[model samples]
Target chain A: MTLLPGRIATVFGGRRWRSLAPLAVLIVLCILIAIANPNFIELRNLVRLANSAAVPLTLAMGLTFIILMGSIDLSVEGTLSVSAMVVVLLAANDSNGNDYGWWAVLAAIASGTIMGLISGLVQTTLRIPSFMATLGMWFIGLGLSVYMLGGSAIRLNDASIRDLALHRFLGLPLAVWVAIGAFLLAAVIQYYTRLGRHILAIGGDEDVTKLSGVNVTRVRITAFALAGFFFGISGVLAAAQLGQSHAVIGDGRLFAAVTAVVVGGTALTGGEGGVVNTLIGVLIVTVLANGMILLGISPYVQQTVQGLMIIAAVALSLDRVRLRIVK
Target chain B: MNETFSIRRIFEGKWTQGAIPLILLVGLLLIIEIAAPGFMTGETLALLFANTAVLFILATGVTFAILLGGIDLSIQAVASLASVMLAQLLPSLGFAAFPVAILSGLVFGILSGIVHVKLRVPSFVATLATGGVVTGLALWVSNGRAITIEEGGREKTAWINATIAGLPMVVLISAVIGIASFLALRYTRFGRQAIAVGAGEPAAWAAGINVDRTKIIAFAASGMLAAIAGVVLAARLSSGSPVLANQLLLPAIAAVIVGGTAITGGLGGVARTAVGALIISIVRIGMTFVGVNIFLENMVFGAVLIAAVAITIDRSKIAVIK
Candidate 1:
């Protein structure tokens, strides 16, 4: 009887090959939701869900790097808010005369990178824990967004940018294409780039990586910067979809990203998951959210459900034996 | 280095680590007094204390959670829920509504404790999830609007506003709680066990402490205090809304860390959080007095929060951030 338990552990725990668990969970959830509400399976609704997932997926893809490093960034919503405001004000808009064209997107992404760079610098130089440093950064970003917003939302008037939502490619919104492009780029970076592998190595064993002559400080900073760039892209995309830049542009998206990252089975303790898992996690979340709405659930209840999923995901992925302390 | 003659030697010694925030407090008072002379009058101080009293209580509670190498983000959410419940029950329950609100807080705290200890969920994530559920429940109870005390029910909550011997009742109540908590922390087994757990759970476990029970108690205390803060906040504002206390979370956490308590747990007291709360109030109102733009407050607050943690955290104790 004891051997049965030991054999089961060997199959699941020792193999280190449970990479597809989150995807399996997504498929099961989709089928269950479809049975509960047939409208969930409709092609039109699925397309809409894809469109909605694009923003969160982008945010999650950025967040994946940080989580893979065994740290967290609570500054997502704040970074999103600031970036969206900047893009709206800089683009061909009513609030400002500066229409820098595509450069506006680059500027916004650059701004996010700067914000992220500050967060990373703070983390490495001051040795402040990522949780506190990122939290403080979140506040700064939020404050800057509110300051720049000045009580009025600027409407994006450019056809090229606005067409991101109106434009469709392969039966999916242009936003989805952008998000998919982001995921592909992130995957390439994760697999092909030295910085990408370093992040996973640091998460897996920082001391060992450091002893191996890796520039841990520079790698950490670049990882955070990359994540920030993605956040900037996510925010700009959200603005494009909404056609307006408001202070609350990223008000409720932080949890969705964190939820997706964690739910994808990426260990909070660092090193076990990758961007591919995050893709499945984001899909699961997006589908669950859309399915709930179709079933006539209230938004308040939906928030609670999402919260529960976050906790459940964390609990399931927790390696209790490996955990020394939880803070 | 002149051992005894140098000012840095005397002022920045290890013995004075806990006193750093207090020293900074004095420096800030001087600045505020010089820059905003009319802002720190006796009446203004009382009002400031009144405004900060609830947060002071909440921070004091969170100090316990932080001491255990964990955090409780649900403080504001529990308080918000308690605020709504207090408003709902004020007419039928009268002043008795206070204990009920606190009880609800304790229940929520225990709920988070159960999740953290029993389910092995980390404290921050566990509390955050509970906070969402609490927020949703508060929204349902309030119907997405602020609930006010009834026509004549204001008289019942008036005690929260009343002054006793030139001190605001709110401040006085918080002081009483603060003093009691300080004594508990200084002299009680419960308090010491919590610190041990925070400093090193493995060591505490080896030393025969029930680490799990201590964590539960610590979380419950945080929840209870958060509830009390919410009830008092509703009384002060004359209304309770679902989102009323949400903004207090970061400030409360900041206050605890600013008091020289380590975010990684251990090495600070509950009383320091009360002093930390006072410092926060001065900085906030003082910034307003100095003609700073309202939009920049959050940025300044964020900077100050980071600076405070940087100053207070003992890097020697932490080998790696993760």
Candidate 2:
């Protein structure tokens, strides 16, 4: 007999209907979690959950486009760390004699953009695999971050910026607001932009996209650059929330972001998911973590669960017909 | 077109790939000796070998997977797990702990292989996920703390630090493994199958090669070797932690690529990886002598890695770089 998941897959086999699977999973998770702990559905806990999901939401938004292009970016942590360090050092911080304020935020995003652009160049111009180029870029970003920090954590003295994390608007923090804004912007781009279409096309079939007269190189680079831009925003948000930044502020984020993107129904092989799916994915991951804590499960087991979730999700969503050999 | 053809020929030339690294190794040693007068002494050489032993072993293990045109990102995590296993088991199992620890790595490697082969997940992603699980297991088993080998267990590991004919026992062990790997890759049916599969999977399959078995075995060997490196590391450090081999991943990968083995696969060997590992060690030591800041070293490695992959990657083999 077909398993429950298989039966669901058969029923919702339409291309458009596939996106509903993650949504269904998210809803079921919330229900199950609410049953486990009656307090889980409370407004305060959810607001906190939304607040926690801000950075990951931002991270996964950018990653969605990249993975949609069938290219992986392992440089999220590096990009995030570099941008975070940039914002901290350039803003009104204890480590440096600078108070560029909002300009610091602009500069942080620009730094992330430039790093992303470099990764794109390395991937397209140099013809290195996206993963390897980004992996190296991750190190470069980390080293750049460490070099900028000069071996110390820099506290953000700018209350205006730190307030982004602390202050609430409509019961949701400004960080979550910023994340929501990013999400909306990403959704618009995914649906309305020509670049978005190109990304999906490339992920679907690069050769076909190229043969159809699309500038595959430019599209790929732009996708990476756009992802980098998001990473920059998330970096600033992360630092603002923490009130301090270090070289490792981006550590642990890459895995979480990747896991969320994959679990959100965006196949690593690309072309099947988008930012909307990632939003659901971000909530699922955030809610799952919160539920685990509420159920008194050991924190360490969370990582194992995330890893297994990635394997299972990828396996379920995998397009086995298109691949004869996997390497 | 003619110039491009010639360039490709030179790069694809097996001897050129191996020769470049050897030249770089010699040139680097010469530069270091000139800069720091006594850096080339036999004592320093032995120290260099000793220092490079673990990295070499780790790199060599990963070479098997790379040779198959896949990668094992879990090596470092597996290595860390193995170290933790060895340290914890040594207290009770003594010498038997080494094998048990190694066996754990083998099992994990097989799991990675199964995930990649059976599930059709990409090697890197499969290994990444497995690495995460292994890291969690390592943390859980060690209780997220360092485990120091007690006096009784210390004696079991002491021989790792011992010298045999002026070479550290660790270095000797790595060399033997390296040589064995070279032989296995050169003379054995498994080695030839690995090469065939890596060269072209469809072609190998058409030629009746068991491509799946080769890939799995390659990953398994990679895992086992990584575990062996972990055991040696625990012996030398007298302790184990979940993060013991954390920093070695990039260096090990760098060693494999820099030794002139093409990341695209089927062009390099275990011997080339040995040269590559030594090259990495020398470059790191050379950076120390040049007084490059420790933090900036990673940046240099990143730059060097990009340059190496750019030079060594076989563009002709891959129609689409992604």
Task: Residues A225-272, candidate 2: write the lDDT tens digits.
Answer: 999999999999999999999877986688789889998899888888
Candidate 2 collision pairs: none
lDDT of 2 by residue, B69-183 (tens): 8889899999999999999999888899999999989999998997888778899999989888888789888888889998999999999999988888988999899999999
Identify the CAPRI category of the predicted complex in candidate 2.
medium
Query: Model 1, stretches more than 4 Å misplaced?
Result: A1-18, B1-12, B36-41, B91-97
Predicted model with the maximum lDDT: 2
lDDT of 1 by residue, B1-322 (tens): 4568675455335567688888878888888778767756888888888888988999998998998988897898899999999998888998788899889999999989877886677787788788877887888778778999886678989988899989999999898889988988779999999999988888998999998899999999999999989988999899888888977887888888787787877778887897788888787777777787777777877887898777667676677775
**Fnat, 2 decimals, each candidate:** 0.62, 0.66
- Model 1, position B177, has a per-residue lDDT of 86
lDDT of 2 at A65: 92
The TM-scores of all predictions, comma-separated, are 0.93, 0.96
Restricting to chain A, the TM-score for each candidate equals 0.94, 0.96
